[model samples]
Target: MLEDKKDGWKAAIALAPAMIFLVVFMFFPLVNTTIMSFMEGFQFRANAGIFAISHRYQGIGFQEYINVLRDPIFLTALKNTMVMVVISVPISVILGLLVSVCLNNIKRLQNIFQTIFFLPYVTNTIALGMVFKVMFSTNNGLINLIVETFGGDKIAWLTDATTKGYWSALFVITCYTVWSGLAFKILVFLSGLQSIDKQYYEAARIDGASRARVFWKITVPLLSPMIAYITITSFIGAFKAYESVIAVFGRGSYIFGPAGDTNMWITVVGYVYKLLPSLMTPGNLSKASAGSVILLLIILAFTGIQLYVSKKRVHY
Candidate 1:
C-alpha cells in the first residue's frame, strides 16, 4: 500500500506543473471573465488606495444583451465576418489540398518548393500586413501601378464598395488571408496525404483505374478527416482576420470607403475594441460582456456543427 501511495504521489508531482498552468492560465481567466459578464460595471473606484476600500455595486440586467441584439452595427459586423469566412476558408482549404497533392508527387527539389510555400506561415503578421496594405492600396500601390500599365484606371482594392450599401472589405482581406493561409493548409494536407497507403493507388491502377478515379475513390475518402480538421481550424482563424483589414484600412472609421459610412467591416471582436472605452459606463460594459458571450456561443455552435457533420462523414 505504501509503495502504491508513493507511486501515485510521484505521478501527481510530475503533473503538477501542467495542472498549475491550466488553472492559472486557462481556467482562472475564463472563470473570472464569465463572472465579469454577470457583473454590473467594469471598473470600480474604492474609498482608499490600500485596506480602507469598499466594493460598491451598479448592477445591470438583460438590457445589456438586448442592446447588443438591437445594434445595427453589430449585425453588420456579423454579416461581414460571415462573408469573409464564406469566401476565404473553403478556397484556402481546396487550394492547399491541391498544392499539397502536387508537391507530394514531385520527386526533385521538393524541399525547396515546400520551404518557399511555407515561408508565409512563419512571417510576422504586423510586417506582412503592412506590406499587403501597400500592395493593395488604392493610390500608387504596386497592384494599382500594374493596372495602370495595362491601361486600366486605378482601383481602390481596399476601399471600394462591392455593392450599394455593402462593404467590400472582404476583397482586400481575402487576398492576404488566402496568401498566408495556404501554408498551414498545405502542411496539414501533406501530412494527411503522407499517411495514405501507396498500395491503394497501386491496386487501383492495376484494376485499370484512371488517376482521377483513384483520387476520388481512394484519396478523398481517406483525406476527409484531415479536411474536416482543417475546416474547423480555418473557421476559428476567421475571427483573427482583423489584423490585415485594420492594417490596410484604419480602424473606427467606415469600412468600404470615405463615402461608405456604413460600418460594414467591424467584426464582433473589433466591436469589443470599438466599445472598450464606453465600458466604463455600467450599462455599456454589460452590453460588451453580452457581446463577448454571444461571440463565445457562436464559436461553440460552429465547432459543434462541424464536429457533428465531420463525424458523420468519417469512415473509420
Candidate 2:
C-alpha cells in the first residue's frame, strides 16, 4: 500500500505541470467565454481603497446569439464555413488516399515522391496562397492566358467581388484549400498503409482478388480508423478557416468576399476577428463570443456525429 501510494504521488507530480497549464489556458478561457457570450452590457469597476473589483451585465439570455444570428454577415459566415467544410474535407481526403495508394504501390523513388508531395504541407501558407492568387488573377494570369488560348472569355478571378467574381474566387479558394490540405492527409494515410500487414495482401492475392477488390475490401477496411481521424480533423480545420481566407484573398478591401453585395466569403472566425476592432460597440464583444460559442457547439456536434458513425463504419 505504501509503495502504490508513493507511485501514485509521483505520477501525479509528473502530471502537475500539464494539469496546471490546461486549467489556466483551456478550461478557464472556455468557461470565461461561455459566460461572456451572454453579457448584455458588461463593465468592470475597480476600487483600490478597499482592494475590491466589481463587474456587472444588464442581463443574460440568448439575445447575444440572436443578435449574431440576425446579422447578415454572421449568417454569411455560417454559409461559407459550411460550404468549406463540406467541399474541402472530402476532396482532400479522397485525393490524399488515392495518392497514398499510388505511392504505396510503387517501390522506386517512393520516399522522394512522398517528400515532394509533403513539401506543400511545410511550405508557407501565405506564400502559397499568393502564388495561387497570382495564377488566377484577372489580368495577365495564367488561367486567363489559357482561356484566351482556347478562345474563351477571360474570367475575372480575384478582382471583382460581384456574383460572377465570387464564384471564381470561391473556386480558387477551394482549390487552394484542397491542395494545401492534401499533404498532411497523404502523410497520415501513407503511414496507415505501411502499418497494414503484408499477410493480408498476400492472402488476398492467393484468393485471386483483383487490385480493386483488395483495395475496397482489405485496404479500406483496415484504413477506416485513419480515414475517420482525418475526416474529423479536416472538418475542424476547415471550420476555423481564417488563415486560408487571409492568405488567398489578401486582407485588403476585398477580404472574404465580405458577406455583403460583393458576395465574398468569410468564415465565422474571420467575422469574430472583424468584431474585435469595434468591441466598443454595445454588446459587440458578447456577439463575437456568441459566434465563438456557436462555432464550438457546431464542432462538437460534427465530432459527435462522426464518432457515432465511425463506431459502425470504422474497422479496427
Query: How does model 1 fare in lDDT?
Result: 0.74
For each candidate, C-alpha RMSD in Å?
3.8, 3.1
Q: Tens digits of per-residue lDDT for model 1 on 1-316?
A: 9999999999999999999999888877566555555656545455633211122336645666677889988887778778888888998888888899999999899999999999989998766777887886778889889989999987766665556324445666787888888998999899899999899888898999998887787888899999999999999888545665665564432242334553556777777556655434334544566777878788889999999998999768
Over the stretch 1-316, how does candidate 2's per-residue lDDT look in tens digits? 9999999999999999999999888887787778878876544445523111135667878898998899999999999889888888888899999999999999999989998999889999999988987888778889899999999998877776677877777788889999889999998999999999999999999999999999999999999999999999998999898878777776553367633444368889988877663435433566778899999999999999999999999986
Error of 1 at 240 (Å): 4.3
TM-score of each: 0.85, 0.90
- Name the top lDDT candidate: 2
> lDDT of each structure?
0.74, 0.83
Q: Which stretches of candidate 2 lie over 4 Å from their true place?
A: 43-56, 252-254, 258-263, 278-283
